[model samples]
Target: MHSWPTTTLPELPDTPARREPVRMFDPSRQAVVALTEPGQQRASMYVCGITPYDATHLGHAATYVGFDVLNRTWRDMGLEVRYASNVTDVDDPLLERANATGVDWRELAAQQTALYARDMTALEVIAPDFYVAATESIPAVVEAVEYLLVHNLAYRVPVSETVPAPLTPGAADIYADIQAIASFGEISHLDAAAMTKLFATRGGDPDRPGKRDALDPLLWRAARAGEPHWPGSGLGDGRPGWHIECAVIARGTLGDAFDLQGGGRDLVFPHHEMSTAHTSALEGRARDLAPAGARHHTHMGLVAYRGEKMSKSLGNLVLVSRLLESGYEPAAIRVALFNHRLHQDWEWFDTDMQAAAQRVAWWRTALSGYGGADPLVFLDEARLALRDNLDTPRALAAMDAWATRTLELARDGDDGVAGAAGLVSRGLTALLGIML
Candidate 1:
């Protein structure tokens, strides 16, 4: 039996009135709104993790950074947060990468996952409370699928060579009752035509012979020759599909219902939408049980390079490892990413990094001699900005102003300036996850 994390996290200051309200963009609501109820003391988050092949690119960094900010803000507000994320160590991309390199898929997953951990640590992302991997949670995944099958929410379909060439090889089981979830297309906001196109493009086998609906996603993929496989109770030797891994892991780590579910904008469709459906189906049958529903569903904007979206396929990825190799500080990389709204798509440029580096240098110099003071005092502007839908650019602007004022005061020989500057330094660490 997989159990929720038992390790305790340190509690922070609990000044409810002093903490600023936190608002975030909700794709489900299609508007910015308060993310938590007033005076709520605990929060939980689940963000989709990477597949660990060509891992830790700028796009990945930005997505993780966006959620990291939310987690930090929640904890800084004195809310205990249970954050769970998955490492998709046994996905198609990992298999394909391993096959191409003639490396054992498991070895490749382990190696790349270690590299991903290093990148995230260097970027100063707070470690998730529960960092579950699909391979390790295979038993949980299989059990969840069996539940869905017994409830009639999912069915096993036969696969044959005559299936469309684009369909995933050996995919056999699918979630059948997609219509059960109300507002299904509202989250992604995709029309029939666009959703259909993206579904086919993003691993959806819309035209699979026995599927009831075009949008139905594979729940279990029967094992094929040369593919990684696991034995299900009665589902045969195959790996779980992309969407089910997260659903199972989230339930095991953070209970069925959690406060937040987040991922990159690209996942709003088949990935997030389908995952929500599967979880909802599970809740329907297990009526006496807790429902795995996210109060807010959020997505970070895609990071692009040279007028194209950063992706492994486009070969336009601005990898974090490469950037570190080129001598760019992780702090600067994070600041550059914070330059845009978390929900707005933007292109990455060399100039952005240069500007962020300069900002970091200025802040470091400004706060150099600063000692200790209440970090919350210098955080008004930053706090208010962040409270407003995680307005990072505005928070950064506030930080710039804080830096300027502190430097001016210090130049004028103000006695309290050093302490104030120190507060600003600590506030940056708390609010922005940046160490000055």
Candidate 2:
């Protein structure tokens, strides 16, 4: 059994007094919104983890740091927050990469996971309350899938000795039914036509028996020779699909309902949408189960290089470990990333990182000579900006101003000004994990 924290959920505030704005990408509106939940004091978050096939890159760093800042800001606001990110130890990428490298899949997954943990620590990202691995949660995945089957949300397709090419049009009803839930589009952002095209490429031909729709994804993929497989109920001898692992882990760790669900913009469709659908199906069967009402918000930042997506195959990736190896300060990386708006894509470049390093150096120097000044005024302004849609650039600008003004006061030997600068530095270091 998984052990969860026994903390009580925070009570929602009465009358929804304009707490800081939350940045959200609503697929239905096709636009981003800066809003807050009514009466909710705490925020819960779940960001997808790496698939463990490649090194953790700048793209990965941007996503994690963006959320780390959000989590830090929320905690600073006195809200009890619980964050979770899962490790996808079992997947197609892991298996394929292991085979090509002639290494054991388990060893590769463990090595990459450890490297990721080291990188996250260097970036000063807070450790999630629940750091789950799919292999460890097989029982939970089975239980959730069983619940769905019992409730008629999921059905088994009989597979024969021979694997089919893809799914056929004959199984359209099952696919359509899965997509009808309220939050179906929250993940994929695709209309019916686009969805059909997208899934077709991954689907096998329907003429073969035991095949469903071409787009119908695997809730459980039957094990092949020499591949990892778990034996249990419903799924028989197979491994859980990529999407189902996340749904099962989230439901198992956070319970059926929680405050917030988050991930990169990439996961909105298919992965996130499918998870929502599965959960809704489960909820419909049991009265106690209901799709968690948390805002399925996504961040829009973390742009890739040269208009190309970051991928291991492309080999244009900048690994976080590599950056650290090159003597780049982790604090610089964190500040540069946090300086951008959460829902906007900020381009990655060498000069951008250099700028962040310079800024950190400037802040540290500015605080060396501080006299008592009202630090709260500066802290409050920055905090408010962060809460109001995660205006990181604006918040960073404010810090720059504080640094400039403090330097002016320090030069004139104003004891009060020097004191205030010290307080400001301390508060930022403590709250934002930005060390002077």
Candidate 3:
């Protein structure tokens, strides 16, 4: 059986310097920041999951594996970590695809979620402690929506019989009002005027009546004919909006303000932005929330294809299952990804995969008769590099140098060579989920 991390929680560190900061990229800050905490060695994290319509792909692997490494590293350092990842089981894509495929929406969701779990296991990404489904969290979602409505952050709008025309300057005032309190531009790294232009082109209209702002996303989207709808909510018969599921799930699982939040860079805009806004707004209303005043740190990894961004809609996509089927080892794929810094995008190429495979082979050969070494020296070096804002690429380069030296020592029959190889393998395994 594959060994898993022991569930016994570690004792909290006594000093701030001893405790690792839960550092992550904050979409709000548009830069990585150390998460503010209520106590030492306690950190909470939430990452949005797939919508269940698309099959798991290289892009999905890159994201989950990246964060899984972070989670493992944090825990290995003796921190108490509670990780939550949500499944967006209900959404417009699911409904439309279900209709086109003539499959039940729930069945589709279940099958896809199961596939995702299997893929994660195959890649050795740790399963999150809380694996929630949006459909199961409907009550929590409704509660959040109700809270927003009460605070005037969200408002219900009647379906317009006639599509609204172009927004005038007066209509722009409504959008501006929501922007003032929402911090919408901050999370997206866009100025207010830039955000307005982008939103307008993406179907948001400032002139729409009953909407507090054109950019104010729907908390509860009224269900249309032939669409999936939840019945329990005080909001009329409709499914939760794409952004609301995350806020509700985070609030329910991680409380008001958790330690770290992360996902693909693509989600930095409307998705993470909305989640941050909603959660912050909710906290402003409740004085007793567990993390009522805590700050959230966010981080995102890069995207790449064959040295380019992988976009299925553009036919440049790569699937994890296909890569495996084509004889790429899971470990090699992961190592190649880790060679790139987690926060920056790098291209995916066969050469990169081959280089990772070469590293694995060299280490395995170098360590053939190796006994364990005191890994702390090498681990400390790697750890220091990682702690400097997760500089994984530089850490990997250090590993490469260490591996090269160890191989040379093995050639000379040095006793420490085997031990050094063992250290390298263990460090890579623990830090990147890459097993030689």
Candidate 4:
């Protein structure tokens, strides 16, 4: 799959490499923990990608940009980062949207995925090292599923009416036996009852008979009529399930046990939880979750509009592409999103864009002027803030203070002041992901 254009990260002034380790909230541990081990200089991340049915909304932008901050933070700290993300190009939602709009599913996925790539480019998000689509990983998916089956970690049940897949005359749908995996619920921290409730609403069949446990997620869906299908296992033509697709893709590209498993808070439950379970199951670990071990998961809060969480089902989307087309600078839109912390869920107002645009204008103007204060101090503050739980609000505050000081104390014939301004501009680009 073709990915978005990569933004060239501007280099900071040559100095000693930064040594701060990033600390983020890990749901499993219920505490803020350092991402890197002692003396570790390499990191990996696997953020779940968009389904691409609806494409780059503000909610979508918030998640990717939030992770982009993490990417920038790790690099600024002199860590080698290997990142992977996926596109659910073949799914029920994608096919349903295509059928409703009278377009082929393949063309729809391609067009929307391309648009998502463009939006990420506009937002200056660093591209993932591996941007896999579910359709592209059938062989790996089949291999992973087979591993579980051979290990007796997964089982087969009758193909049901809920699945779009056609019944394999004698073969049943495959599922990961959650009962067999002792660590299934470790990631979400949700009790069995809570997991069941969420699973039913978020694509689980708790009432389905013959499931080893009510929470067992589908491993592979059998071949269906008028929908995408691939040869998955001996059960006949099928497609991989949501959780399994992520497990294979992340493990395939990033290797086993990576640093982070990140996405929106909505994914905290069955999606992240079950995927982590699948990953652990494949590796023969009976009681572990995620490639990053415990506290390895992070999630951005949902973006809300009109007192409701922004979603395609709600029909109240504020798209990033539309905002850019309406004359808002991409950097300004980024500033608008960054005004809040990663896990802070807040509602959007039109004033958000207005304030961010003004902020961008002021920063641009300040960066081009001269000042006596050393800009590197605030640059350090910016890095510290981001390292501490990806604190975008505090990081932006540091940027604002530097910009104010720069413009307020401009002086003539001072090469020192002129050099300070240039250094501060580069600092913002490298530390805060602001190109100004």
lDDT of 4 at 89: 93
All models: lDDT? 0.77, 0.66, 0.66, 0.82
Per-candidate Cα RMSD to the true structure, in Å, reads 3.9, 5.4, 5.8, 2.3
Which one wins by TM-score: 1 or 4? Answer: 4
Each candidate structure's TM-score, on Cα atoms with residue i matched to residue i, is 0.90, 0.85, 0.84, 0.94
Task: Report the lDDT tens digits of candidate 1 across residue range 1-436.
Answer: 1212232223333433346668888877788878888889999999998887776788899899899888888877878888899988888778888989999988888877888888888888888889988888888878888888887777878777653321455556545556555546656677878888999988887887777778878777877766778877677777788888888888788887888899999898878877876777766733323224687888899988999999988888888888888898988988998999877788998788789999999988777766423344457667777788788998888777766766666677764433566567667777787776
Q: Give per-residue CA lDDT, model 2, range 1-436, as digits (tens).
A: 1222222222222212225555555553466665346566777877778788778888788788777767776666556787877998998889989999998999999888888888887877777888899898888777767776666566666544444321322221112136335556544567766765545443322243444443445676655557787874645666787777887787776777765566666665566666666766666722323333345556555566767766576777878898899888887877877776756665677677789999999988877664644566667767766666567777788788877877776678765543566667656654556656
Worst 10 residues of 2 by lDDT: 9-18
**Residue 290 of candidate 4: its Cα lDDT?**
32
Candidate 3, residues 137-230, lDDT tens digits: the string is: 8877777777766666665566643333212112111111244353444567776576666655433464567766657766666655566776
User: What is candidate 3's TM-score against the reference?
Assistant: 0.84
As for lDDT, the candidate ahead, 1 or 4, is: 4
Residue pairs clashing in model 4 are: 166-223, 166-224, 257-291, 258-291
RMSD of 2: 5.4
lDDT for position 340 in model 2: 67
